[model samples]
Target: MECPNKEKNLNRCNCSYPSCSRKGLCCECLHYHLRNRQLPACCFPDDVEKTYDRSFEKFAELVMKGKI
Candidate 1:
């Protein structure tokens, strides 16, 4: 989709998924994750993101624990 802000977004994206096609494309990444009932890795801490558990439940848990 040729995101104009891709390089800039990449600097802040913390996704650890090695082969993510939407790595720097925030819109695509968010839509993709939401369709799967998950949040993109950018919503999580690096430690948590690396676990590949981007579920809504996980995000809630982290929020409740003040970990997000």
Candidate 2:
């Protein structure tokens, strides 16, 4: 039950938002994000995620604008 992928990504991941409960465990990470109507950290690049705006609406806006 070890999430090696997520754990490993932690070292290089640019997700600096506070209150992130899924520092590891990709599955749980996705679940947590989606449950809140937002995309996971991995979906965005460093600069974008740095905005600390993890919302599904924002992600969709970026997608529609082809900025993501």
Candidate 3:
């Protein structure tokens, strides 16, 4: 199968994290996040993505603190 990233036209995603396994496939991306008890990259703003806290609990904390 063709890679989903083939259509992204991106040299790099703005996810900011260097170690994300969900770098391209949107379906796999969401699945990975759900399996890991975390939110996907789309939930975060630019600044928050820089922090690299992808956990659901951490995202909730950000909401509670009005950071995201």
Candidate 4:
């Protein structure tokens, strides 16, 4: 089934990974990341998102630093 909010979600998506099929699909993106033991790009700020360090550790660090 097509996601009705894909376009709207894309407007807010911060993923920097190119050629991502899940770019605008939050559910798929989240599931993919979780399966890899990582968080999706949208979980971090633009700067951090670009670093591609979507690990739970990274997210926790950012949270502790109040950067998220």
> In TM-score terms, which candidate is top?
1
The residue pairs that clash in candidate 2, if any, are none
Q: How does each model score on TM-score?
A: 0.97, 0.72, 0.64, 0.93
RMSD to truth, every model: 0.6, 2.2, 3.0, 0.8
Report residue 44 deviation for candidate 1 (angstroms): 0.2
- Displacement of residue 11 (Cα, Å) in model 3 is 10
Off by over 4 Å in 3: 3-13, 19-21
Q: How should the candidates be ordered by TM-score, best one leading?
A: 1, 4, 2, 3
Write model 4 residue lDDT over 1-68, tens digit each, in one string.
98999999999999998999998999999999999999998888999999888999999998999998
* Stronger candidate by TM-score (1 vs 4): 1
Candidate 4, residue 37: lDDT: 93
Preferred candidate (TM-score higher): 3 or 4:
4
Model 1 clashing-pair count:
0
Q: What is the clash count of model 4?
A: 0
Q: What TM-score number comes out for model 4?
A: 0.93
Which wins on lDDT, candidate 3 or candidate 4?
4
Clashes of each: 0, 0, 0, 0
In the range 26-66, model 2's lDDT, one tens digit per residue, is 68877888888888777886777888777988888889989
lDDT for model 2, please: 0.77
| Per-residue C-alpha lDDT of model 1 across residues 37-63, encoded as one tens digit per residue | 999999999999999999999999999
Q: Which parts of model 4 have CA positions greater than 4 angstroms off? A: none
Q: Which model is ahead, 2 or 3, in terms of lDDT? A: 2
The regions of model 1 sitting more than 4 angstroms off are none
